[model samples]
Target: MKRHASFLGLCCLLIVAALLGGCASLPAPRPVPPTYAIQDVASTRLARIAKQNALPGAAELSGFRLLPEAPFSFNARIALASRAEKSIDAQYYELRNDGVGRQLLRELRDASLRGVRVRLLVDDLYMSDADELFSSLAAYPNVEVRLFNPLPARSGSLLSRIVFSIHEFGRINHRMHNKLFIVDNSFSVSGGRNIADEYFMQDGQANFIDMDVLASGPVVREQSAAFDIYWNSEQVRPIGQVASFDLSPEQAQRRFDQWVGGAGHGLPENERDALGRTSVAHQLDDGKLDQFHAKAQVLVDDPAKIMRGRMEERFQGSVSQRTLAVLETARSHLFITSPYYVPGQVGLAQIQRQLQGGVKIIVVTNSLAATDEPLVYAGYARYRKEILKLGVVIYELSPMLSQRSGRLGEFGKTTGRLHGKTAVIDDKRVFVGSMNLDGRSASLNTEIGLVIDSPEIAADINRIISIDRYTSAYLVRIGATGGVEWVEQDSSGTTTAVHEDEPETSWFIKSKNWLLSPFVAEELL
Candidate 1:
């Protein structure tokens, strides 16, 4: 009887170990303190400065410039953080502890040391690895870091967190997808680029073709206000309260210094020199960086979007709604570029209606070989044939495009993937922001973007697209037999047929997509 009992005990222990290893058990929620508002601190400080200097009001026209090159975009962000005299505000969806992430953290820490109040808000879904870093940054008196929609168990593997929070998945899955960086409350950068090596062309394995707009006018005020809304929302929790860590200010400073000194040390000398040469701040100071004046409006989703059922009531004035409204007004042409393009039946119908009304529609999105999210691509693939039937033109970015053809010339041997989310209507209005044309973006996530009323900017974007799309992408069309075939253009402007959805994609990827498509829910993709 004793031997039998020992065997049973061993079996039970093995079962428990298996469960924990596979993330099959749910984790208990921990207690947290109540959240309070931080107020619009950055804007208030900027208002005082503007009044003292006799500057224009926050509602006046603003200056806007596009940062299409990744190196310049990264440099602009560093310059903003370095030059911030009073306050800095930033919010992002994902921030890794890799190359770009470390550099930004060091810059923010240095800015804090110089007496600049740095406030950062990041989505907590991907914060499992960065909890310690955030806690260390929060140790500084001048720095504050918050995580939006934090999980019940703050530290764990990604699968474990998902399984443990499975019951609350509906709420936890809704993330804040806004990417905004404001300095001194008077200048801001808002668009699709997150804080990562891929977004900034630093990752040699894969680089994202992204876009950002640097604004220094009335639009910055609106962006600042949106940041305040999310910063003060009850859904945001301080990183210190969520994760337990005890790092002294001195220790934090030492870590930051090491990170800063070691950053880019592995890069070749030419890449580093290229990065140093495209400094927008230096050009602006020397009266070389050109800018465009425009009337711009910042649109953001309600902070209550983090709430599951309450999101519908607040969806009326959301960024998605405003974007659809703008699309409805398009009469001549509509140009759209989204990395993840999963427009459901309703969106397709809307596009069909526009097509019937004689409007030309052109869309550029990631091909299966280039997309980082194959599941999302599966969801998008369901609509390709239906969209083609409506006479709309579609282009998928090539995964094997040469690095020399990339917007950032410094991207060495990196595979290019489309990450910019933009739309142009009738060459009169332009939309650039974090919103993707997918159901998740429309109903599940909170997004922010800018609508600029400037024909000059619109024309510039139209011209770029007209020139680049044919060279860097595969044009999808209906074949003679009524099936899809990809067409490509060679360097000599010679066009040829490539008869596959993604000719360059590996068989493993194709098989994975084929197997996963049946199980993936379109709304969740």
Candidate 2:
């Protein structure tokens, strides 16, 4: 009886110790500045940038040019950074420290060295080892770096961060999904592509078929305004404050030079020349670059979106709201391209309403085989039949399609995945930005995009969509018996029907998706 009692006591002691250790492993919330200080910074920065860059009736003078190709898009950003005489502000959802990221960092560093003030804001959820590099970059005199919604403990490993996220899922899951690059308060690029190798086709294994719009005039100022809001928000912490690494300016510069100089060593000479020749700076200096003019408006979610427990009433003028307003104005047709599409009941109802009004809707999204996020695909898969029944034409991109349509250099024997998020409404307006047509984009994460009143741009995007439907995507339709079928065209102009969710998807992948779909919460995807 005494031995039994001692065993029970020992078990209780172990349980208590385990509980204490678990609590200790959890991340402690970092301290932030006082509310007054945060408010002061926000107000001051907003007012100052508005006064300096805002023009009277500036909307009438806005202009936009589509950077449809990845190489051209990459070059445009580097050129803007190289030519920026006054300031450069950039914000992104992810900034991997790969070859493409290093090259852009080098450009920003060179710009700073030439007396341009540079501010970079990046989301911290996927920052990984880039924290130290950002810390080093911030050591430059004319440059500053801030991370949005950073993890509490910078020393924590990825597994610890995941555990912390499970504990604080509500706050940590909501991210800033905005991508903007503004230079000199005059030019900007806002779209789906983040700063990484895969985005620029530098990743040999996989490359994203993405899009960006190069804008000047009024819209650029609007993007800068959005950047200022995020930059000054309380959630944004300086890299120097969060990262433990301490390196002097000279050391940082040397490290940056070494990284940048070593990039593109293995690339073929032709590809290297292609990257070098498409420089916007060279074209602008030679007076050969063409600029298109149109009325443009920048739409972005409120920075307060990152705050937890906010009422839905607070999201009155959100990016999604603005997009829906534009959609309401659609009279003839709507074309949407989203990589991960899971339109819930609200979206379904909206499309049904549009269909009832005789408005044609066409959607292009990634297939199960082409998607990088199989869980997101699972969420989207359940809605396919319902959407097809509602008379919405759907196109699923195939992985076998090469990225050869948009004047982007041919990636030899590469698999294509849809990553561009865009919409063309009635061939009158075009939207290109970082907002995905998923539940997370709708009510969870913050997003940003540009609405350009340019029929030419809308028509161009529509043409691309039509071409992709025939060449690189499968048309999903309901059969006579209420089943769904995928129709694709062959190289010899022959059409075939594929009676599967994704014809090219592996059996194991299909099985995994089938097993996981029943367990996933669609709204969180």
Candidate 3:
């Protein structure tokens, strides 16, 4: 009987392996219909403001507003959506099916209902829970939903699909990390935040300190063109083509109503009123910006980057490469904030060259206690000492022993992990977008951001994040005996106590990470 059971288990294992291996597949590519962004918006409210107040071709980089506060940043999207006249094109790495996410969807549906065209492109990694919602949303007239680099097997859960379809690992491993949102091709917002409660600071469990740049003028048009490229790429599949539209138009309408109506986590009426009063639409209606104006250019990775073998030689013009090229021009202080930081050997070499050149560089990243990915923390830990010894200033976010005020103030009350991917050079140029200072963002995932040549923008970003770095993070440094130490800071931004170990992390976790970090690949983080 024991032999029989062992033989049965072996057969089961063989069958599972066969099923997994069989999932390795993609048929001939389905031809994507070409669609370009609507560039003629001479009469729209946004165009009136953008064109009137836009910096001339002299500056090159144009209208921009930094969004650091979560509530205000999120409100900006709704404001744009509410006022979109002709079209709204938005894409993101993730969109949770939570309250705020559903609210955003409802806004899109409402815009579509008003004869405004709506297009949403999302990465397929997190769509297992939201695929049915996408199917329903796609049913609305004038609303289109698509997935970029969709996983072939969608019937099972995301994990099961990955387990069964291990054959498509090459394509499945790469993803679209880019986030771009445009209204009427006149105004746009591009940055690290996805359409989720945590991104917007509504997540009760935890949140991210994120950044985005809302812009107008020439930059918006360039952003629209980038969106067109992804929308027309063969790798992007319409929601209907990828998932069954089980909900009919009538059924979808009722469901959409339910989804939107059930979302009770929207901003309070008073906060909404405050945001509306200060909206760009409100300020721009008079044809000028109460915000900073600067020269800027949009950078985006090609969608085809994810459609091919990741090991293939990379091409130029990638967002990261372009941003780094801009960084190469840095002449003074360099400030970098990447929540999931694992600077591999190549990145470290580059940093060393800059440090050797006397660049005052400051890096702010998540500590082991605050990081969302402990395995990623393991990867980051592999080079933590090497990085510290290179004379670079490093600040790892500490959620437990931090004081708060302004945007950084919320970290003390709620769990806050740094999610802003930003770098400022000499306080003259700022790179804000979705690119992290890590191998995954550098090569595997597609990214987008603006390289702004504006001191005003850079200064504002530096000011807000500097506040967080001083108050909410541990200053990692080489101790007297060559060991690492975490220096805590007071609310007054003065260094106080020193801890010999990772302040909030347990010994078991630290030991496990120390032991397992050797196998954690930086490129996969």
Candidate 4:
């Protein structure tokens, strides 16, 4: 009888255990999405107010206040040693894609660990991957990470997107489109490069055409200040504060190592590596920037409260300030290089007006072959002919630029992609930063750039753009005879051209463009 009782008890326990297991719910898995891939105008009324009441170094750089290249003191520092001096360097490090991007990220991570204040402001679109190796860096107490206009997407379907507003939808199409990294208010790296494998050329050695400017002068301070505004803004969230993510350094380190070791972790390994190298040991000591020349003014378009008699809302003032300055100041020539080009009717009209003013405007953006975001290209196509009619020249990059440059030597194929947003006016001034020449850039996203007034610097930027224009870019030409052609140079140092009117685009592309055009889903691109 005792043996019988024991067996019955055991069976009842097993049944209860099974029932409990059935009732328990498993945790949901994190979502991962596929990799994918701004503007201005205005008048001069505010210019006088800004000029009269601007920051210390604002005026000289804003409007043709030419500073002769004589010995002027600029702040500089070396890695954790020395005194402050001017940074006279005209040529800064140009890091594109993965090769240098990984190094940069590593450097950022190290800088934070050593008690050096670090700030990372990325356009929210680039931070979709929850699996990125940020926790290790985020583990550092002084480090902060914020996403611009980050709205998490829940589903990839179009219906899901439409049903989901920018407020609730999983896909946030209108994003914060600026990329900035400021360390210790002394050194910075800004440009088209995002913290990704492709931008750093670490993604299969695919050379993503990108640009970065490493600045150390007073400009660094200016850049950092703008970064601080975005850092403290509502759009950003500290990495540590992100819910559902609570990991200590030891745990994060293990995860990072697994990621770096190819344990099937999804992040681009080199970006993590870059984060590792930005140690506090690399902090610039003062006296290092003595060589940098020219003063700089930081132009930022942050959303700020605008009150109009009992109404208050955020305005993209930075966009208005910077773009209006550039458009109004453009004299003989205008050079624009943006990866994404979407000019709606108003935007197109603005360019036309600029053209009517007799400015030679040349624009270089991504082609269907080179662009990662096809939907953006669909929107761009709507304005291509109209833009050409208004005397604006357009060029699209080839996907080959997406392949790593110089990694495989001269014999390897070169894909010339344009991943930089810059503007040069009459070889007198240059603007470089995260903003693009698009509607979203003008009204939706927060953007930042440097308005540099050094003739030598402008010349260098102009040369770079011109080289890319004639060599790496395709020329969309409409002659006086009304002939439209997509002209390109041959690989063998020859010239060959194709006309868009000739049905040159493959049927596949035509169908894809057709399908994506109607959606007007400007947010995703």
Candidate 5:
């Protein structure tokens, strides 16, 4: 009996081990497919200027506002403008419920009730619990909400899952990450902030940050046109309308009722109360809004319709065409703030040329500790050496550092994440919206921005964001040995070089990059 029992015990242990091992061995997700096509140099240049002068001065020079580096000062500068009152209201809010999200939700609800048309665009990556909120928002007569790309549905019945799996496998990875909120075509909010708790810093753990610049001018008209294009495009679709599972009009109505009735009050643990704030809460009430009597421009790009019919002529060359032009026109300095930084050989060349020509090129991006996507960082890391070599000043945001701690400034105790995409050049122009300096923003994802030609606004942006905050960010410096060191000053006033423990980034992460590199082309970043 003892011998038989021992054999059975051994067999059970082996079975358990196999089961756990199999679970652990599940393959990492496959990367999204290549989405950018290489284009001819000439064609690339044309596309850059395609949106140039579209709204006059839209091609102004622009710079970036990287975290642990700068707070958005452009908004404040506009707030300070004393020009002819154009009735342009301005507001600044943090990521927590105290600022943007709640304010946006309230405006949306009020607009709906008053029958003013409301349209919202959000990057699908952050749509964790927004589905219900969106569905509710869609119920109003003046409101129409669409999702960029939605998750594949699991069929209600066991048989249904099997039925749909064969046909629906490709819809999982690609998503719409464009973030824009347009109000009646007179005002719009565009930047890095998405409709999510992290973007709002309501998550408590991670300071999900991002910046959005609210603008009203002839530029808002362009933003409206851009929003209409995406809304009507096939890349986005109305929510809850997908056939399957459980969403019903009644259910949607119930959600709407709860959201509107309890507006501004209750939200899930990970969500912000977007509905509590009133109209333009952050800005001065009844104060005269800023006017953009100066030249302003707008640029919009997307992959939905392949203009010129050649895949190569599409999104891959979009930003380069425009950005290169902006650089060439820049006089004194240029600022760049992108969450993901992966300027390929060709793109980096232009930037290098600009730096050598005596243009003050400054870049603010996330450090490894602050970067949410490590693989993207892996690709960006490879270019650091080449970029810094060109004499461009680079600042990588430090993890958990506040804006006040150093140059970046003090961050809200629980809210801090730099999610702004901006560029300013020579105080003559500024670009702010949802485009990153990666392949994705270039070709795969649709993006939009405004080029403001107000030197006053530009100076304000530089002061609040660039000058004050960059001190806390890791300054990228090269040593004589060609070894690049991430330099940062600690509380003791000592500078140190940061290196990882593994000396090898985790094998798991490397393997992911290796497998995804082929398909994870930069244009679609």
Candidate 6:
């Protein structure tokens, strides 16, 4: 009977493979109607407000504001969309159909209703069972939805999709991980965030401590250029080209209304007002936008990076590669905040050189217990001792942090994880964006970031985070036996408890790590 069952299973698998191979082939890339960002916005409200408050003689430069709060960051995008006069170009790696995601779509719908052109480009890797919503969104008069790196098998299990599209594995594996939002080609926002409940601190199960920058002025033009590249890339496809939609325009409006318009999880008038960027809009209205004035340079991975061969990828002007080049110029101190920091041999060599040159390096990352990607921690653990021996300071966020609802937000039953990616150099420059120090960010995925030359902004960011002294993170150190130890500190920055193992890490997970760490490669994590 066991033999019969095995044979039957094999037969079923073969049958499914044959069926999928026959029907799941992706359609050939169709000609995408080219669209470019509108650049004649010098007279627009955002452009005028941004210029009014630009750095004294640096009015021609860009301006930026750090958004560390979840509620404010979420609302800032909404506010910009609400105030959008001409066009809104929003791009992200992932945009779920959850509560907050739906609300954001609703805002876009409203913006379109007011005659604003809307273009939403989202990655298709995790977009399963969302054809109806996106197709419906595209049905609106002024809205267009496109997918980045879309898959052939749209409606099936993730495993089935991968299996059916195995022939194109190399292409499908590469993804566009850039995130940006622009209004009227003037005001923009970018960082390591996607449209989801967890990112906004609304997910009671768990949440990430993240950061975003609200950018305006000259640098926004560069950002819009990056968006235009991906929007018109061959990897992107109009929603109608990938999936079939039966919803009429009227039906589309009804569908959107049902999803976000007055229901459970719907924002009440008062709450919506609180969530909206009325204050930001008011500041713009008054031409008194509070932001740091800085000369900023934008870096974006060329959209064609994913389509190139291995050797060609290394020279694709990738954001991670360029960011590393900037880090090499660090004179005194380098403060890095990345959650999944699996610095491979190349990165370690860079760190060694920096330390030998008398540069101080500090890293803030997630502990095994607090991280959403537990397996990724295994890659970091392999280099923890070596990193500590090189005189680098390390801090791992503690799980105890979730007990209270503070700046990191209420993780509730789960732990707060670090998701922000930024680095400060000599307290005079700041690099903020979606690029992580991990292997995947280096080559597998595309990313974007900003390099700002402004001591005031760097100092302010450092004072609030990274090296604030008072933090809910454990000081990682090498023990006398050369093993790792996590020193838990008090509010006054005194060591109150010492953990011989990864604090709050379960024994089962430890065993799993022991088995899996050896097989894990630094670059892949």
Expressed as tens digits, the lDDT of each residue in 344-434 for candidate 2 is: 8768889889999999998999888778877788888888899898899998887765454422335556667888999999898989999
The alpha-carbon deviation from the true structure for residue 418 of candidate 4, after best TM-score superposition, in angstroms, is 1.3
Please say which candidate is ahead in TM-score: 1 or 6. 6
Q: Write the per-residue lDDT of candidate 4 for residues 1-525, one digit (tens) a residue.
A: 010111112222433444432121213323322110000101222222222333455433322121110000011111221211211111111222233333444545445555444445444333324424554545555545444544344223322222232333222333455555443334445565555444433354233555445454456556655655655665555444442356766787666544444222122222111112222222222111212245666777653421111111223355634565575588788888787788665567678777888889888888776665555667787788878887887877755432322221121343434567777778877777777766546654556677776666676566545654555556776755677666666434356655554122467876866874675444333
Candidate 5 regions exceeding 4 Å error are 1-107, 121-133, 154-174, 243-251, 259-284, 290-293, 303-311, 316-320, 403-416, 489-525
Compared with the true structure, model 3 gives a TM-score of 0.91
TM-score result, candidate 2: 0.85
Q: What is residue 19's positional error in candidate 5, in angstroms?
A: 18
TM accuracy, model 4: 0.67
- Candidates sorted on TM-score, descending: 6, 3, 1, 2, 5, 4
Candidate 2 residue 149 Cα shift, in angstroms, is 0.2
Clashes of 6: 0
Winner on TM-score (4 vs 6) = 6
RMSD from true fold, candidate 4:
14.8
What are the models' TM-scores? 0.86, 0.85, 0.91, 0.67, 0.68, 0.91
Candidate with more favorable, higher lDDT: 4 or 5: 5
Task: Tell me how far the alpha carbon of residue 279 in candidate 4 is from the true structure, in angstroms, after superposition.
Answer: 18
Question: In candidate 4, residue 187 scores what lDDT?
Answer: 47
Candidate no. 5 TM-score = 0.68
lDDT of 5 by residue, 57-117 (tens): 5443222222211123222222222111111121111112233354445555554565444
Candidate 2 regions exceeding 4 Å error are 1-59, 155-160, 264-279, 308-316, 403-409, 490-494
What digit string (tens of lDDT, one per residue) describes model 6 on residues 1-525?
A: 000111112223544665554447666767867999987777777777777777777666788887766777777788788888889999988787888888888888888899889999998876778788888888888899999888888887555665676566667767777889999998998988888877777777777787888988889998999899999988789988889767678987788677766523333222322212334555666778767777889999877788777833643478888898999899899999998888888789999999999999999988998887666788888888899999999998876754552536545676677888889999999998988887777877778899999887787668557433235688999999988898877667788788888888889988977886676455456
Regions of candidate 3 where Cα sits further than 4 Å from its true position: 1-29, 56-61, 264-288, 308-312, 315-317, 402-413, 491-493
Native-to-model Cα distance after best TM-score fit, residue 204 in candidate 6, in Å: 1.7
| Clash pairs detected, candidate 3 | 61-294, 61-295, 61-296, 405-409
Residue range 26-101, candidate 1, lDDT tens digits: 2333455433223344445443433333234634667777777776787788877777777888899887778888
